[model samples]
Target: MNLGIVGQAVGLFAVTNIDDVVVLALFFAQGAGRRHAARNITVGQYVGFAAIVAVAVTAAFGATFLPERVVPYLGLLPLAIGVRAAVRVWRHRGRGGQEEDERTGPGGPRLLEVAAVTFANGGDNIGVYVPVFATAGIVGMSSYVVVFLALLALWIAAGRYFATRPVVARALSRWGHLLLPMVLIGIGVVILVDGGAFGL
Candidate 1:
């Protein structure tokens, strides 16, 4: 039992750094004012990712069946997400009125909306995560959760920082609309390759 715990901890720590970086990059690219919406996003990300990990772990235990072929197809998800993000960037680049409304109600962004956006942003991460959790065994969950929360806090802080700085904010806001699509596409290609879509 001790060995199992230690092994899980080590595996989690190993993966956490990479995962956190990816998460941070994704949220950062989404633009400023994300902090206000980030609370819900963080919670949703945690829950959604936790569920995926749980499922992956369970499937590893042979409690459920997911085909080997299907795993590779997971790459398509990120690819699609990337394409959509690129499109959004293109659309927003030309249109001034299409900016996301800042008028989220007192309750903030809707919980489901937050969850949906987080999940969408997280699509590429999921492709990376599902395989990692599957191989890392059952011990990685606690460490993964802790690292995820830590990264979330950092992401929120970074968002706030970028949103507040006038010069930096304006520059980022301008380029942000251009950058998001490229980032998404890059993530998608990476995911596709990782998933063995190109035959490893």
Candidate 2:
């Protein structure tokens, strides 16, 4: 059961998107003052994710009702988020350095700011979670939470390590933005198919 749950969670995570990872990594690499900020972002993300999962599970168990068409609508969410993130990246291409500096100032990280940004970043994940829970049920919540937390920790650690490596960070930044939208599109497609939208 645990293995099944972990596998499903991993699949969900993989399909939801990785743009947040790239953004968090860049944020972490850009400055020292934002370490706490990154932590706050992670906290906010998990909180948001957990809330989404809870609601989804409740709906799955029939404790709360959701419209049958919700899954199809949810499928489009990831695509939208991906597009928005891609646009942000394109807009920041020339001014990436300026943007980083502004986000990570000399003053300690802003908790609310981090939370807000993180919440926004997790939007795609929320949409994906709804369909996942509606179909898979809550049998995997514990394992799903554990796996997500572990991945979050890994992402944070990787961000800290990459922040100190300017060359690697620069190289990653070049293509990272382009990948965000593609990842989200791919995930959205998968979810849509899973929901039988494509007759799968």
Listed in order, each prediction's TM-score against the native is 0.60, 0.54
TM-score of 1: 0.60
Q: How large is the C-alpha RMSD of every model relative to the true structure?
A: 5.4, 6.4
The alpha-carbon deviation from the true structure for residue 104 of candidate 1, after best TM-score superposition, in angstroms, is: 6.8
Q: lDDT, candidate 2, residue 137?
A: 46
How would you encode candidate 2's per-residue C-alpha lDDT over 1-200 as one tens digit per residue?
A: 57877887877775664655655564454334444566665565566555555655675556655455554445565666667667866787788678667645553323443344444445445556665666654566656767876776766666657655678667645654565456666656666676675466
Candidate 2 accuracy as lDDT: 0.58
Off by over 4 Å in 1: 1-22, 28-31, 34-36, 96-171, 198-200
Model 1 Cα lDDT, one tens digit per residue, 90-193: 66565575465642333333344334434443544444556565665566645554555555566556655654467755665566555545655665566567
Of candidate 1, the 10-residue stretch with the lowest lDDT total is 102-111
lDDT of 2 at 86: 72
